[model samples]
Target: MKAAVVSNAGPDWEIREVPTPTPGPGEVLVRVRACGLCHNDVLVGQKRFPFLGPGPIITGHEAAGEVVGLGADVRNRRIGDRVGVPWMQGSCGQCAYCATDTSLTGQTAMGCASPRTTGVTVQGGHAEYVVASASGTVLLPDGLSYEVAAPVLCAGYTAWSALTDAAPGPNERVAVVGLGGVGHMAVQYASACGLETLVVTGNPEKAGTARELGAANVVTSGTELAEIGGADVIIAVTPSASQASEALQGLRRGGHFVVSGIFPDGSLDLGPRSTFWARRQRISGSTHAGPARLAEALDLVASGRVTPMFELFSKDRIEEAVTELTRGTSRFRAVITY
Candidate 1:
């Protein structure tokens, strides 16, 4: 199998030939059709994420493909069935946090409790073939293309998760910080929910993009959003912790501030702890959605209520895609077609 592997901590991402492994019990081998290139891939390649390596690691979480083989006891999914591999590759199903009632509370502990994330702790989908647990694989609707479904597996799903956690009403004003993949989806979802969508981005050039994505208004910074009207909910979708923290001031008191983006060090500078308590606001974080929420997100996409725009790249041009992501030049999500 041809795969993209990261060799070291610097680190190096190179295309190499490797033997494809057959599926073990309760697993399925998917012939990867498309994989979304996220900044998380860069973090994994740099060894900044949870990867503990002997050497190279295949890194890509947002995968959409057709199943080619299945292992023992995998009766629900058959050969040629389309599926998507999300970020939460696997989790301890028996844990209290993973229980149905507890998983949607936007708690970080739920993710920290015995979680196995794709492209982070395990070999992921930056290859011609990937083996995923059959139980964790999501079935894609027939009408959804692999390229279109790829970003929904992570970027769009995370936006759906964070916005659902905030639970904003139709009359509320919602602000999406950063007009990238996740932020754009957040804007669309918020607008679909009939909430007034406000967008905050450091790049002034993205104002047009934000507006196109259904944002009611666009601002260059968080303070500008506050000057207009405080947001009932502020979802930060930038990798910069400082930028996310600054957006907290734009939220109305008793509002929710959800961190949907991954930071470099996992450290956020939220200024004074006392001020956070004084506001009586709810601060939460959401990872990729659970199974049910993932289904809802996919349904929203399939229904044409939420759409993703992307720049398609072939697997052979993976380096160019990674470079464009690192340079923050990709206007649309980059999906690598196999």
Candidate 2:
């Protein structure tokens, strides 16, 4: 099996022949057809994730493919099933969080004290073959292709989960603070829900694209967003916490602000304590909400209500994909096709 191996020395990726992974108990071996490249992959390659140690690693979590082998004790999934391997692989069901969570939607990785996170705590799906817990995989919709389903596993899931967490009212408006991979999908999801969607991006080049992606209006900054009466809900999908902090000014009184992007070393600066108190705004962080939300994300894509914009790369061109992603030049998302 060929995979993109990351070397921590150069923090670069190289295509190499690696041993194919086999399914363990309660797991399944998937022959990966497509995997989406995420910004976390770059951070992993740079050894920013301390748990990954200082060496080579496979860093992709948005894997979509077909199951080729099933392990003992796995009854939910079987060979030939088309599935998607998401970021939250599995969680200890006996933990305090899982034991108390009665939603029956499955515990999310963010809430789990000990989680089997793909590409972080275990092998990822950037390779031809990857192993995943049968219970953790989502069945891909009939009409969705592997390339389209790949990004939905993580990027799309995160965007939808953020929107869901905000719990917007029927007549509330939504403002997406970025026009990157996740923000682009957020706009479509908000629009699909019949909400007025506004996009806030610093890049002028993306104004036209944002409008095309269902954004009713495009603003360059939070000031511009506030000039037009502000939004009822704001979803920040940019990696910069500073940007997210600035976007908070666009949140209407008693509105919800959901942060879905990873900001490793950034902190949100609420300009003044009085402003936040007076507004009575709420702020929350969201990741992959749960398996149920992931299924919903995929359904939106399958139903053609939400379409992901991505650039495809072959297995051999993994380096090129990484370069484009790190340089912020990918069309929206980058999918590596096996």
Candidate 3:
């Protein structure tokens, strides 16, 4: 099988012929058709994730493929089933976090003592063939194509989960920080839910795009957002902690703020502890909520309520895809087609 193999840190990935993996017990071997490039893949390539080893890692968690082989104890999935491999590969079901509520089990990967994370703990879907736990894969809707389904596994899932985590009321306003891959989807989800959607982005060029994505209003900063009557729920999907903190000013009193982006540096300043308490603001972190939420995200895409904007790249052009992602030039998301 041909794969984009990472030899060392940085945006370096070489296409090489590697042995195809076979499905182990309770796992499945997928013939990857499309995989989305995420910022975390770049971070993994740069060795930023401490859980990652020295080198030669396949870093891609947003994979949409067809099952070619199934292992023992896999009754839920079968051969030729279209599935999506998410960031949270598998979790210890016996743990309190996972055993408590199946709906929130997807978050177990973050708190679980032992987690099988795709591209981090195990092999990723950057190659033509990848192994995944049968229980971890989500069935894709028939209406979604492999290229479109790929990004929904991660970016769309995260955005939808973050919006759910905020738990905004029916008449409340929702603000999305950033207009990147995840933020773009967040805006659509908020709009689809019939909530008043507001977008806060530093890029003025994205104002029109944000509105087109269902944002009722677009503001350049937190100040601008707050000046126009703050939102009841603010979902921050920007990688910059400082920018997220700045967006907090746009949250109305007794509002919810959900941080769904990965911030590598700088602490999240709460700004005066007294102000946080006085405002009665709530903060939460959300990731891949669970398979149920992932299914909901896929349904939204299948129903045409939410559409993902992405640029496609052939398997041989993996390097070019990563370059565009690192340079922040991708339309919204980048999918590597196998």
- Candidate 3 is scored at a TM of 0.95
Model 1: per-residue lDDT, tens digit, 1-338?
Answer: 99988776466667889889698888999999999988888887876666843347988889999999999999878999999988765666667666654343224224446665667666788889988888778999879999999999889888998899888977889999888878888899889888899998998888887888888899877778889988989999888888888888788888888888788855556777547667888888777657788888888999999999889988888888888888899866899987
Report the poorest 10 consecutive residues by lDDT, candidate 2: 101-110
- State the lDDT of candidate 2 residue by residue for 236-287, as single tens digits: 9999888889999899999998888788778777876547767889988877
lDDT scores of the candidates, listed in order:
0.83, 0.88, 0.89
Clashes per model (N, Cα, C within 3 A): 0, 0, 0
Comparing 1 and 3 on TM-score, the stronger one: 3
Error of 1 at 124 (Å): 0.7
- List model 3 lDDT by residue over 297-316, tens digit each: 99999999999999999999
Q: Name every residue pair that clashes in candidate 1.
A: none
Sort by lDDT, top down from the best: 3, 2, 1
Q: Report how far off residue 161 is in candidate 1 (Å).
A: 0.1
For every candidate structure, what is the RMSD over all alpha carbons to the true structure, in angstroms? 2.5, 1.8, 1.8
Clashes in model 3: which pairs?
none
Candidate 1 Cα RMSD after full superposition onto the native fold (Å): 2.5
